[model samples]
Target: MLTVYAYQKCSTCRDALKWLRDRGIPHEVKAIRETPPTVAELESVLSGTGGDIRKLFNTSGVDYRELGMKDKLPTMDQAAALELLSSNGNLVKRPFVTGDGKTLVGFKESDWAAALG
Candidate 1:
């Protein structure tokens, strides 16, 4: 089954969920804040994004700013960055989807159509 790591209050996550529902795409919704993705799962998802760790972060999130990740991330090693993200869902991009050999960050209707269709 496909899994969507998302925060319930995020509008983008809502839209992504709707997009899947409208298309009759089955998925399991996981509250990112309550249960963040595991390190292995994050690694799998990262592969789909071409190993660009920056894409895995929620750049606009409060935590990202509060923690000064924008400045710190560039200096952090891959392992440290991955560990930080795995421990905090608030730092991850919303509606992170993983399934069918693909992983997606955030919501883009066209992207979903191409990836899932």
Candidate 2:
């Protein structure tokens, strides 16, 4: 099953969920703010994103800035980055979705079509 981790108040997240529903895509939604993805899961997503750890971060998020991840990320290893992401959903990008051996971050309609189609 497709698993979508999203923040309830995020407009992007809401739109992504609506898009899925409109397409009749089978998926399960999780409240990301309450239950962040585990370290193992982040690892899988990183692999799917071509090993780009930065793709997992919510660059515009308050937590990302407050924690000073911008400069810290360059010095941190993938393990450390994943650990940080697992600790706070707000720091991670919204509408993170994975299923059928595919992983995706954010919601781009064309990308979703290619992945799910």
Which residue runs does candidate 1 get wrong by more than 4 Å?
none
lDDT of 1 by residue, 60-101 (tens): 999999999989998899889889989999999988988767
Q: What is the C-alpha lDDT of each candidate?
A: 0.90, 0.91
In the range 1-117, model 2's lDDT, one tens digit per residue, is 899999999999999999989999899999998999889888888988889999999999999899999999999998889988999999889899877787889999899889987
Best by TM-score: 2
Question: What's the lDDT for residue 112 in model 1?
Answer: 88
Question: Candidate 1 clashing pairs?
Answer: none
RMSD of 1: 0.9
Task: Count clashing pairs, candidate 2.
Answer: 0
